[model samples]
Target: MNLDTGSSDIWVPSVNCETPPLCKSINKYNATASSTHKQAAGSPTFNLGYAVGGLTGLRATEVVSLGGLTINDQIIGEALSEPTDSYNYPFDGTFGFGWSIISATDQNSTPLDNLYEQKQISKRLFCIKFTDQTQATQDAIPPGGELSIGGCDVEADYWRPLSVDGFWQIKMTKLEVGPATDGGNKLTLCENGCEALFDTGMGPIGGPPDEIELITKQIGAHFDKQSNYYIITPCDIASLPNVDFQFGEVTVTLTPKDYMLTVSPQICYTGFSKMNTKYQKADYLLGDPFLRKLTVIYDKDNKRLGFANLK
Candidate 1:
């Protein structure tokens, strides 16, 4: 599971039987990794609906061998078991190839090859295609598909045809701050420079900043007496907001529905969770929320990401 990303932080889960901490636990895991000078990390405690029983990421060496890499510098621990629900993530575990570099023997080689030749992190991007047809939790995920980073193998993914986007990268135009509606007149979301991030480690695209700035601007422009995240369903305005996605060849238009995080009013900024200001550079990461939206084909061979809308 070698990926070409700037960050090399690995993730694992902390085992706190009762009243476990999610993000805090991951912080602790990072502390441990930093001390060893190893880029390893533990995920916060969580569950996959049933029992916490997925992830089970292989060590760096194991993946190299399996993926037919010439080098084996990576070190992966067996996926450990733990209770979920603390980290706000539904799945059990994640395998991060964030720092994985391609081996000479690897069939799919991206621009990262120049780096690997120079013994550096490849400047390539990758994405994972969640087999929604075979979607499952740690307890019930069907052994149907496999995930490919630098190349594709029927054995790696349970589904076939290998429909994928070449390299995982997109140009973000802007960010939309607020107003979530189902039809004609309401709120919206990240419109400008809102590039989608894709990663196995992240639970969802986390937003942390003066989120209220975005939310309030769009949301406040319309309804007056609603909470921060949710746009007031003004009876006066009988339509949904026009959700917009801007791509070169494809323009995705989704009617604004209730914010994904409809439950919390103030927490609308994150829609899931939040990151600090320093970490607020990237836009809607292609996290769980993202994978669920499309069938991402990662061509490590050519360093391209293929995108297909799933039915």
Candidate 2:
């Protein structure tokens, strides 16, 4: 069992098989509660078939304990050949962490897919807020506080403070490109709570139409022949001013030179890009790049996120 601050899932490269596997954790029950359309209260979660390349079904709890959980217990994931065939995860297969019974949306708000607004940690999609051991992760989640199954305390803030602003999950208010000085459109900010979903595994920035269009214009980037993604010149502009994240009156300047987000080295020019299509109510997906800039605290209790900049 290994520990990855990235997506959650118990990947026992030894035997889980490549065809499919079972719920190594509690996400099963949680997902079952999502849309039990059936009157018998069928399990909301399911025995999702994942392609873990050449691995085995490693129990989630087993992995957590094996890794000597000190903080932010590790969640097992599936390993695949394509690297993006998450069937469920483009970042590979992840343990179900977002379920109606235990998500913020299930708590009262509506849930997307199976991620409900009920609890903080979803037993089904049990993913952790990964940070680069890259000097950004603050006091890790006390491994002793490892969560499993339906275990949770609404009043409990298992969330510890990170060195950075705990990856601020701010709302995308609006975006602008280029340097009002250089006259390039290069920005993607959020509204009140950045309704965008954060996925560390997927490509850097992807979202609905209007947003993607604005970013491409500012960064001097273009769409790939594939028409699904964009490409731009890679530069040492990590710390450039064109890339800005606005949270309230607080406008964050993501200097690639100082902080690297998106986790994709190919995106030479650092700027924002919107996902041309809306998957649901969610607009954007905060990729690894933006997350690496700060320590993201998934404080499920209060139903709000926290972040702190280590750089």
Candidate 3:
């Protein structure tokens, strides 16, 4: 399952008339079969909105286990209907790590929050390290990443204070593009500061359409209407400039190798895309592409975010 810091509620597809056939291909949580399962009072319905679309489902509680840890009567959503495109991913479901403030139900405590409340963990914190794919060869397995609950490594290189109290948001000071070398000619993409959300659940780095279009154009990429992506020649990947994001005192530089996605032998796509307007509170949504390079710590106690080079 994908750890989603952008949303609330743990959900999996269930056997129902509206359930997609693809749900059978992956793991399903049969609420009816679990002895500890109990329907939520009033059988309240829920609709979870996402970048792709939305998922409609019923709420319930059941025993949930992770590794050797177990939580009884954990709240979960049994998805009855979802977007057809949602099944394309390899994961079975999402384990929401966002704050209880973002939950759909009145009983807003997330599983993680409950774990802390139940004293299963000592700290209200978690850390994530995403596998960097740039080092992978064609058809070769990439190095796996790690996720740690309760606390994170204290050896992080930088720990920046979060600008906002929710959604792991930080204040972005600027964005620049240039060679990785010091004193290189850097082109400013976004000069004015804006809020950025660091989300482990999303794939690409997203922002306003105009900014995305400008950045793509600077990198010699063209928007492909059919694919809804910006395509560039694979050969040009090495020649493209590094994209730098300034988050207060810390600056993260993403090389072409980190921001380009190989679509085919000769074609690649930019990892930056336009975000949905409705969820535009943050000027940018920094996802896996950005997170993969760093060990990110979500410090709920401090209400801040910390980063260090992934070891």
Best candidate, lDDT-wise?
3
Model 2, span 179-267: residue lDDT tens: 53255443534433445555543435556666666555555556656533455545334434546655445443545443323435556
Q: What tens digits encode model 1's per-residue C-alpha lDDT throughout 188-229?
A: 445444545445455434454355344434433332234423
Model 1 / residue 80 / CA error / Å? 12
Query: Which runs in model 3 stand beyond 4 Å of their true positions?
Result: 17-25, 136-144, 179-186, 277-280
Local error of candidate 2 at 91, Å?
A: 8.3
Give the Å shift of residue 259 in candidate 1: 5.2
Taking the tens digit of each residue's C-alpha lDDT, what string does model 3 give over 10-108? 888776627564365467777778889988775578778776566878888778787566777788888888766654666877888887767764355
C-alpha local distance difference test of each model: 0.37, 0.37, 0.77
TM-score attained by model 2? 0.49
TM per candidate comes to 0.46, 0.49, 0.90
Per-residue error (Å), model 1, residue 302: 4.2
Clashes of 3: 0
Off by over 4 Å in 1: 1-73, 77-93, 100-127, 131-169, 174-196, 211-213, 216-242, 253-274, 277-281, 300-303
Better of 1 and 3 by lDDT: 3
